[model samples]
Target: MNARDPSLPLQADELSGLADFAASAWDEEIVPALTDYIAIPAKSPMFDADWAKHGYIDRVTRDAAAWVESKKVAGLKLEVIRVEGRTPVIFFEVPATKSGSTDTICLYGHLDKQPEFSGWRSDLGPWTPKYENGLLYGRGGADDGYAVYAAITAILALDKQGIPRPRCVGIIESCEESGSSDLPIYIDMLRERLGNVSLVVCLDSGAGNYDQLWLTTSLRGMVSGVLKVEVLTEGIHSGDASGLVPSSFRILRQVLDRLEDSKTGRLLPDSFHCEVPAARVAQARATAAILQDEVWKRYPWSCGADGAFTLPTTTDPVEGLLNRTWRPTLSVTGVEGFPDLGNAGNVLRPYTAFKLSLRLPPLIDGNEASLKLKTLLEDNAPYNAKVTFVPDGRAGALGATGWNTPELSPWLDQALNEASNAHFGAPLGYIGQGGTIPLMSMLQKGFPKAQMMVCGVLGPKSNAHGPNEFLHVPYGKRLTAAVAQVMAAHP
Candidate 1:
């Protein structure tokens, strides 16, 4: 359809007005708010032993609630809802216009962030917001802080134009970075308060590129556990025990070898067996076509003898995308047996442990997979070593089939296609994201009938949950405008 198409009612005037509003407000208003929002070190509750001690979470929540209140959208009520001692949740609503027209649209995002890991450039700090080369750099800038701004900005922009809106509820959580520990309790408490909702939007995902609007069709669930192997009572000098004693590290490696193929990076355990869905495979092919040249080059580090670890030359691009989005994967994230640099010595450690992080397919049962993984690892331990398995967290994967919401597919495709065509000269493509958004599953449980649209400003090389994290300001502004378009076009 052309830009002037009457059926898709987003006129050039409306688009220009929204884009202009976003550009001006983002620079003069959103940037300052984001700067202050990023300044607070509101680490997840899991990272901080006493989250309330520093008052960072509270401070950020209050700041977000204040921003929402300042919007003053007609018929919208904003407030911070607190449960017992858990982190506060900012809730705001734009009531529906007429009777039986109250179709609630709940928007979700988080205010808290993962612990800021080390290895940052000299100019960038975790809490300090720095704008450079069209990027806003800081901890919470991309992963979540932008959501609160984006949702409010979009709704308020529409309200400024006097567009009547559905009952839009924005729920910004304070513990999303920590697996949303207290969110369920908060949801239960406010279950009655939050009435029937028809649509949901989660802005905590990444876009494929700044030029295109990416919609995630599925999310892989995460299961984290510790694998421990005890081979001896105490460390022994390598000179004396090198030939006689079995190394705990070697035994740990053997057990891990059973679960993962060392050469192919494929999980060998049988418990994680779920075939990629047909629709996702098709989406992957499209994504591969779009990302052919940029995907490999986007890697931060150079590859070894195996090249860039991409799909085989013969493999279809669609298969490559399917592998990442719909398949299960495993990685050893941390080792407990490694010694500090200063304490390193030629000694065989008696006990070794490593943190195992497994990504389950969208249809796989996380708990069952975790149990199967533990059994496989323990059974594979060499030298009859003592083994222990400790599970840390598990979240079920989420998938949205077109069959569940047939009306949504075409709406999303059109909205995204229109937005992409306006910004870049191309149609927007869909893909599945590998990262876990714990709240998706939770929201589905609480609001089973809600149709969701998961889109965000994070793009390739944005590097969320890592040092030098940044948000593309211009792209973000455009993305917010796209969100406005999508909301306005919602049926």
Candidate 2:
């Protein structure tokens, strides 16, 4: 069939055609490619220090680039760009089908997977791909490995139906799981080539549920590091040091108290806190109504002997949403200077070290917060113990800043609602994600006027970083078609 006029609005049949094309592309091509991609442990640079030496990151980047080139997209220019000491990225551009259009649509996603976490179902493994009941189970597939495929599929589907769109460009990176530390350099290098980006479709976020499209309004920033406290030069017998010397573990606990309130998960520093925007608060209230108990019930909590599951900090849905997204919290992700349970002895350990991960509010400055955290933990020491908090990453780059999306333009707003209703038979939903996407903040700074469409297939129980992660294939197909609809409606 000939391509439809660029100025004409897409009809219902056209949207259906896009869906058919996406389903075919996914089942026949995307799924097979992803299954293979999942089998290769292309862990992010953060999790795998020897990523370049291992060649997994490069392999996936090359594989994705090859797949895009094989699509034979008309006027498509593709390149696998590399900066000397960093992970590689896939960059592609397709000319606009719309006449005299200068606006650019940037599609962003990552190819890196998180570390293999424990607690998978007996039959499931991190690198083992399992397709059953319309879900693809494995790591990376949902976290963002399917992004490049879906981005290209959306454009191809639009072309198949002769739908018009602005110029499209894709930037698929391989270090997102590691906080996207290498992305800023590439963005600066490609600034001119990126053109006037007016719309951004970021597929590296999450969905509130699989029912309808969910747009991420904001993301929380993150600061991670190692906090170590030392009381003695070597281990000593507990009987000899019982009351004469201070325990390192006790000192560690005291230092952490300066940062958090043990009773509540709130960060003690006032600088970490920020006023939640009224608009976001109102949206949270509406979302709470839509999700109800789902806001807190989605977690896999352990049950007690009384046959009751563990409770969350709050049962109120609105407060739950606000707490996770807007509030600052601390977590101890890893520990060191300890022995295995089987090898533990009755000796006082010399030191205690904890890998601390602090989630900051969206409006806070990550660099400043990280600096403050280092000082808070390292400066004052109980018993004059040797304490130190070293932030992650290189000398200057410490933490990743969060992003609050720019207000949606009228055309894009209407387009999102229309696409949601047409594709999923529901209206668009807005919510904030607690996870951090470092690229969003960079893009917002670079393209201050751009409208962001941050949506993904990571829905309930489709854990991205945890075990038993899976991608909802049906929702992916609908989302691809919906993306095409939105791009076609872009003015």
Best by lDDT: 2
Superposed Cα deviation of residue 155, candidate 2 (Å)? 0.5
- Model 2 per-residue lDDT at 38: 90
Clashing pairs in 2: none
Report the Cα lDDT for candidate 2: 0.91
Q: What is the per-residue lDDT of model 1 for residues 1-491, given as tens digits with 9 covering 90 to 100?
A: 11222234667778777788878888988888999988889998867868898999999888888877787767678778887778899888777532345577788899998887888789898998999988999998888898988898888766666444566788889887666767777778777767887678889888777767777778777677788999788888989998778888788778878878888778886657577666667767778888875654554764568786644423555555666667777777778877999999999888999887787777666666766776787774566789887777423322211111113556656776787676555677687777777778767766776777887777878888888899889988888887777776665
Candidate 2 TM-score, true structure as reference: 0.98
Cα lDDT computed for each candidate against the true fold: 0.75, 0.91
Per-residue lDDT for 1-491 in model 2, tens only?
A: 23567667788789789989999999999999999999889999878889999999999999999999999988999999999999998999999988778999999999999999999999998999999999999999989999999999999998866677889999999998778888888898899999999999999888888888889999999999899999888999999896888989999999999999999888998999999999999999999999999998998999999999999999999999999899998999889999999989999999999999999889998999999999999886999999999888542669988888877889888999989998899999999999999899899999999999999999999988899999999999999999999999888
Q: Which TM-score value belongs to model 1?
A: 0.89
Q: How accurate is candidate 1 locally (lDDT)?
A: 0.75
Best by TM-score: 2
